[model samples]
Target: MDLSGKVAIITGSGRGLGLAYGKELARNGAAVVINDIDRASADGAVAEIVAAGGRAVAVVTPVGTSEAAGELVATAVETFGRLDVLVTNAGILRDKVVWKMTDEDFDAVIDVHLRGTFTCVREAVLRFREQGGGGRIICIGSPAGQRGNFGQTNYSAAKAGIVGMVRTWAMELQRAGITVNAVCPVAATAMTETIPFLAPHIESMKRGEPLPAIIRRDVGMGTPEDAAGVIAFLASDAAADITGQALSIGGDRLALWSHPQLTATDFHDGGWSAEDIAACWGQTFAGSIESVGEEFPEEVMPK
Candidate 1:
């Protein structure tokens, strides 16, 4: 996946998973545009990339607005001459149960993860079209999006919406020679270090200690760099035919997540009334009700 001569914009790339992605893309020869709301962090990330012999520039801005999104694309083109890839990785967390979530909390998460992605991808697609219809759009997703996560109503909703758009965009942009896909990644970053189960591992990693296979293989948690390769592959010409897929990667694991589909189907002539459905509810659809979220009982997890 050689990206020589390509230009990429990676939002929220000042640190953590975003920074990892920016570095990997640049390592593969793509000139990167690093974006984040924090000016110091964004500049530091760019300096680090440049120090390591990569071409990189920073655009410090929150990505929810059309103007900011436009600026990111403009920076990529004006600085590097052309834009080839866009990674919508900017996001914020407003974790709360549905009943406890406020309007502000929900809106903040949606604005950054969902609407920011929409605006950024929209701008990138416009550039791709003007440059003659070929580009890559890789949106970040999560396990919460593919299934569900407790006390993460806003996060799950935003992530799920991102994947939803990925599917639609893949179809819409297919003939344009542009590919769209989502990557649901799990990594032990500052954001995940708050989790009780992952805290110790984070510390061990800081001391240069190796993680146990149980944590790495069973939990599928690893350094952000482990997930970065997926971005590099997806951004390369080798993956041009791999659009509309939701691929998960971390630690010793990498898997493809299936799209939502009907588990059961039935035809009712003239449309059956509610009363008619009540009679057969016990045998037909009731048993097929699928469980949602990350359903790992304590007994099943490796300790």
Candidate 2:
């Protein structure tokens, strides 16, 4: 996808998937703004992009705060003269089962993933309106959120909330030529290194070896570049008509997720009694009530 004159701000782009996205966009001729909390990493990314003959600037700021998010957009506009894409890829993970999860864990994850995405998108929308042109908002999501993970209540909830934001903003911003979408990627990155099942493969890749066919086939393991391709496509003008979608991308796999809707219903005159509802519950919904993590066996699951 060509993004010749576009200016994009990719949060958490100091390294990993966000850095991959910035590099991909820059490679495709878009001016990039790399935002990260780590100053050295952000500067390193900018230096690499510039050395490769791409235009980029590093913005060292935490994305979890409104002021920082606003500064991110302002930096893009001031440096590049216009903003065309905003990728909310900044996030943190704090994993624990509900009972063991602390308030700090839950709040931190939510603040960086959900609230940070909101703040960045809000600022980008304001700039897009001022420019009087279309824009793109690409939010990062995860498979854990789509199918709840065993010990990631906070992380899953935050990612799920991002999809909700995507759908709502897509509708609210369509008239303004803004397309909002989320990419649910399962790539081998620093984030996925925490998964025991994927850690070995990530290490193997880091050592410049090809992953085993079984691991690649089963889990669609690949580098961050694999996911960045999808994000770049969504940021292009070619995807102007596609909005409010949760597209899953990993290696050679790509899939679209279905929105939640009522699958079955039982109705009485006004409302049914508790006893009546309980009597019909099994027949009406039991078969359709899906179990989580049925696709992966227990032995293969991350501990």
**Candidate whose lDDT is highest:** 1
TM-score of 2: 0.95
* Candidate 2, 1-303: lDDT as tens digits: 999999999999999899999999999999999988999999999999999999999999888888998899888988999999999999898888899999999999999999999999999999999998889999999888888887899899998899999999999999999999999988888788888777877898989998766655566657788888988899998898999999988776778888888888778787889988889989997878876841644545666
Question: Clash number for model 1?
Answer: 1
lDDT of 1: 0.92
Runs of candidate 2 with Cα error greater than 4 angstroms are 297-303
How many angstroms is residue 12 displaced in model 1 relative to the true structure, after the best TM-score fit? 0.4
On residues 1-303, what C-alpha lDDT tens digit does candidate 1 reach at each position?
A: 799999999999999999999999999999999999999999999999999999999999999999999999999999999999999999888777889999999999999999999999999999999998599999999999989988888889889999999999999999999999999988988777766667888899999998777767777878999999999999998998999999999888899999988876666789889987987777778888889977543633448
